[model samples]
Target chain A: MIWRLAFATMLVLAAADKRSGYQDASPETRAMQDDDASNPGFLWVQQGETLWAERTGNAGRSCADCHASIRGVAARYPVFDARLGRPITLAQRIQQCRVERQGAGPLAPDSDALLGLTAYVGLQSRGMPIQVSIDGPARPFYEAGKALFETRQGQFNLSCAQCHDGLAGQRLAGSVIPQGHPNGYPEYRLEWQGMGSLERRIRNCMIGVRAEPFAADSPELADLELYLGWRANGLDVETPAVRP
Target chain B: MMRRRFLVLTGSGLIVPLAPMHPARATPVQVAALIAELVGDATLRDERVKLDLPVMVENGNSVGMTVSVDAALGDVRSIDVFAEGNPLPHVLRVRFGPRAGAPRIATRIRLATSQTVTAVAKLADGSCWRDRVDLLVTLAACID
Candidate 1:
């Protein structure tokens, strides 16, 4: 009972201390993300800005033609899709809109064009607190995501919670692990040498643990994205964040 | 430490053997030679310049760098940056205008490995000043 209570107390404290990765990042990295001139991620944003206005597909429609009021749109992502009856990540939403709505070809998962668009759209919600709901139809996916977050797998027999939740701010080899918040995504990682989506980073982690990574368009990743989004609730969206 | 040599023809039609340039990146000797070529017969000093880079870097992909000079900021005409362990040693060059303010620039560069990053500032009179910082770069943890 005492151990359970101690764990519960720790949970309460951890919940209250929901810090974004930016808060944990070094000052140099912070400066890079803070300054548009120095941050390399802005290069992707620039590409995205170009793509937004360019007409494409059989419909020859542009993203700028339709989604004019996209401010704060990225913050409320991994939202419940009524047609799909499941949660859809922002990237998936863009893919869906590009194909079905705009009559365009499906962009390859994690492509620069796709990442550029993601970064571009995500930039609209910068400084806006993440606001996703786990209510009603979204609850089941959220539960699945929560389960996956806590599930132990791979050769290391580690769960996302073990390191991200329990050992955050602590050193693992040469890296200081953050809480695995998905706030700053399509972020420029020094390791990646380019911008990458949250899904790609998630898959990277899965592979890091020697586990089978979920498919790019897999429902599991969407579920996981939902969970991470929920976990990172209230943190400002830091699109195109620079990370070491 | 590793190097590859190359031959260059002088303007007077004389072939001269320059310092060894690494097959992939620039070695210290090659970088020094490049700096010498840029400075020509002008005086080169180890003062009036500052190279700001992290002493230890986690990854070599994108390292932020800041270069500055002493009080003679306005007369500074240009600055050249060289990385000792990158595929290309001369990473960046910034030429300042007459109306340019304090001689300071912040930029990001990719390092191939752990090595010294050198920056040289050329004044209007052709005199050059420099500073260098040696940084240790470690590999990434999430090696997927």
Candidate 2:
């Protein structure tokens, strides 16, 4: 159960040079992200705002009842939980509270309800730096994530690192390869024509490479998220980020 | 309606010979017929009006569009926008009053696929000016 492999030594990203996917998007896209009225992601944020006040389930409570505010909470996501004994993403944390504290049935992953709350909470951390912990119990998961990111897979046999790391700025066809940062998640991907979680984005890449995607609720996703959060340490969270 | 005079101008011989049964998915023939309907007997000129939209669109869901006509083209009457390939060919129409300032309209439209979007500007003098833009949707790299 002990992970003996150490990946920190091999990977040396110049955190200073870490550029957000926002910097690589088109001008029109940047404008869309900048304009709150035009940003479709705000739709989810608005939905979350409503859900925050509406009481649900046996507890007859709203998210507002316990957590008065969501500000700065998203910046510390994919956190190591003592009870769960594993790292959980911001989205999962929301569901955990809904099911346990609010007594609401678990919302389906990638559903509007879940995405709405995630986008809402993530918005509070807009411009705040990502700061996921990789120490102690979170370390094993982080290392696992690092291994997955660097491993070759799928019909194309491409690794996430081979593109996002080795060729971050290079053109893959027309699009400049993004460093694959998760800073802007529950993002409004023009391709999807709606909001999507980090899991959808990662699975999409796997599918793009003709590789099998992990399950929507896979622990591997959380592990990957932990690693990505650690990698994007100082990058600002642009939740509900407009992406082409 | 005054728009029906176009049917008379084209004569019964070229009145499409078919009704728009498929209200969705505007065909090239339907687009031409609709343009004719808007044009009436007036000739559709190809100058002094502009329809601006991105050539290579990232997605078809919400493509930004702008339509403008030259102020020198006389008192503006109306500017009608159309997409040759959308479910509804008549995307939007902006009617201008005598006091309306600039003859321009900027908004977004969804493209069902690659096609030409045209903007027809009608002056109060009955002269019609028009512009068109062809666009391609880039969509996504991975998902099919």
- Would you list the clashing residue pairs of candidate 2? none
Going through the candidates in order, their DockQ values are: 0.25, 0.16
RMSD (Å) per prediction: 10.2, 11.0
Q: How many times do residue backbones clash in model 2?
A: 0
Q: Return the DockQ of model 1.
A: 0.25
Q: What would the per-residue lDDT of candidate 2 be over residues A1-244, giving only the tens digit for each residue?
A: 0111222223344677788999988777888999999899999999988998889989999999998877888988889998989999998999999999999999899899899999999999999998888999999999999889888788667678766776667665446678889999999987677899999989877766657998987998899989889988899999989988
Error of 1 at A113 (Å): 2.3
Q: Name the TM-score of candidate 2.
A: 0.83
Q: Docking category for candidate 2?
A: incorrect
lDDT tens digits by residue: candidate 1, A169-226: 7665566778899998889987777888888888877766657889878999999999
Q: Estimated TM-score per prediction?
A: 0.83, 0.83
* Residue B64 lDDT, candidate 2, scale 0-100: 78
